[model samples]
Target: MISKRPVHVHEAVPHGDEPPGCTSRVSVEVGGRVWLLDREADMEALWERMGEDDLGADERLPYWAEVWPASVLLGRHILRNAEVLCGRMCLDLGCGLGLTGIIASHVGARVVAFDYEWPAVRFARHNAALNNVPQPLWTLMDWREPAVRAHGFDFVWGGDVLYEKRFFDPLIRLFRHVLAPGGKIWIGEPVRTVSRPVWELVRREGFTAELLTVEKVALCGQNATVNLWEVTIS
Candidate 1:
């Protein structure tokens, strides 16, 4: 059972005149269960921030700030298979608002959620508190960093993370480094041009990739199709 705890207040971005994007609450339903999450109300402000100061590779993408459709589908998958995760150590990579990790924790997994953006980590922590699930350890660190490479996880999960071709090598390396023996990876992505090559690479690396499900989701007021894949090292 989830416990209700006092909400810890973190210093949020100032909303002066401009709308505060993180003020709204979104209710996400997965496997007949509802998880309440705090979401950024305005994406334009976040995009503007990303554009400022000649953004670099890691800093240019503000995609982590929004809850994507893939995350929702991934959360449902986790809930549906909660029994398999009991007592396992799970890693929610690029956790954004932390829905995946929170759901895993609720179902008995020991979860650790990490995101490259500081605001993402903060919001993830807050959302975990809101849902009253055991809060996963939240960290603000890039995947390329050596510190993250040292850790091992029984399960690695990500949502909508394979959109960019440039991220493929780094992600593959991270998967190889952190995945424990007999570990599995769960990914949810919208079918995009860049994803096919990544899957080819996964196959070449000796992992058996299987399509688990296809879900049609509403994203930014439009319907989008997302695919969930399960990969295990052969």
Candidate 2:
């Protein structure tokens, strides 16, 4: 995995719960390395007790669970198979905490990491520093819009970003737009049977798709099943 880079820490928020809620911490492992994050607290409080708590923005998100299957696969694949990433230009999309991008950077890929949520974006940047990876280009972006500023990435990655069927189309559209021809798009998602249509669409769009070996992913210390998606861009 990438070496930890120096973090540009933001001013810490007041140490108390506010309007929506407080912040919790989650440690996402990419490859064998782990990153600690102070994230916006969820109503369930799954990650709140992991460590010290801090307050931050609490905008409702579609998927706010502590453990994610997709991220595990992305991390494992790149870490266990470093040759897939040597010297590649990569994008880590919907990069909650930036684990996948961090792993890519560690393996010598030049990476750009992005997420829409400020808290997640902040954590992503911090994780890059925490893991001692090369400083990745970071950005606040809505993948649904035209990403005119970023182009020609050899690889694009996302994990567990397909929970809502409504967002799948636009997400796939953005993947098609950002990846260089002959590049790769890898996504890790749990077996949400509803995602079959999106998989079919990816295949129809001329990208080759395959499922990786399913594995038990650790989240907040518990185990969960995760599936991997490897998309070969034409």
Candidate 3:
């Protein structure tokens, strides 16, 4: 179990009312160290909240509630190549739970992390403070219509962000606008059929895309192969 959330969290809900929601704290191991992360305790309930709150079409589901293996893979890779991240200006694009950004900040990088969903940003900020590391400047921003320009990031990275084709253009726009000259974008995702076209799209956009590594990780109650894709301006 990759730090499984407890089946039942906190005190019970009273009779004839909505089930109480909670922030489930799980201890996660990243780069040979234990860090505490707080996540929404019930995902299905969170999805219902998304619908009730009108959280936009992009957030059709509460994908940010769990600690994805892709994020864990990125965290480990950052430790393995700490030299590349140290003192670098990095952006944790679409950062959920802020694991990658937190680790980057821990290893001495100046990081800016953002998520479209406010709940995700809230928990990421909480987790960073819980870990007692240097906090990232968390922003609630939409990639499609960014309120502020994220200029000059040496590295722009995200985990499991290539699942949808609709975001390919905006992602490229971010890379072109925010990434510094000779900057790199690393995205981590489990091998899924839907993600196959993203590689071709990367080349079509004139960026050099390569398989940085294939990390074998346990994800969603199964063993999965996570492809760490690195893209850069050609």
Candidate 4:
């Protein structure tokens, strides 16, 4: 569980632009259970557009915690299709909020969730404790680092990580280095055209792929074009 701190220690951004903060929340149903998240900070980031300031590296803030729709879709599909995650050693890369890892642990898998963003790591840990999920090993490791050149895992998981072009090549190379022989990787992507190259690259790496459809309806809204990919490394 997360330890409580004094309210004066941290200045929280108001939920909305009003005098009274609006309640920001998201709920997803996964593996026959519902997960509820209340994140005013994420809502503030949404209103800020995540790229508004200097709109570049200088403007980027630490701990920007927005939950993506793809995470919800893919986490559910992985739990459904994979025979048994129980007792498996899993690595969740770019594990925003650690939803997928939490679900994996819920099913008896040991999970290591990594995120480059420090804020994401903090929230992931808090969310895990809040949901009664196993407290996963959390690290602030970048996939492109040479230090991770030899790290590999039985199952690698990620959700909605293909949003930027800069990280694409590094992400693929990281997966190639870390995935064990005959291991599986799962990704959930929206119908973004840029994501096609990622799929092509995965196939070129000698993995067999198939797409699974997921129905995701969060309190924020409904996402219909969510598709989950199950790729098995040969």
lDDT (10s digit) by residue, model 3, range 95-148: 777788889989999888877655666677777877888878776666666554
Q: Residues 1-234, candidate 2, lDDT per residue (tens digit)?
A: 111111223232222312133256666655555665444554255344443333233223423233355676778887876786888888887666567777778888888776664555555666566667786776656676645344588888787776667767787687778888778788787777777788888778777888867787766666777788888865
For model 2, how big is the CA root-mean-square deviation? 7.6
lDDT of each: 0.73, 0.64, 0.73, 0.62
Taking all chains together, each candidate's TM-score versus the true structure is 0.84, 0.75, 0.85, 0.76
* 102-160: candidate 4 lDDT, tens digit per residue: 77777778777776654555566666766897777765565666233254577887776
> Could you tell me how far off, in angstroms, the CA of residue 65 lies in candidate 3 after the best superposition?
1.4
Which portions of model 1 miss their true places by more than 4 Å? 1-22, 49-51, 57-59, 146-151
Give candidate 4's total backbone clashes.
Answer: 2
Candidate 4 to truth, TM: 0.76
Q: Distance from true position, residue 88, model 3, in Å?
A: 1.1
RMSD (Cα, Å) of model 4: 7.8
CA deviation > 4 Å runs, candidate 4: 1-25, 38-40, 43-64, 81-83, 146-151, 214-219
Instruction: Give lDDT: candidate 4, residue 165.
Output: 64
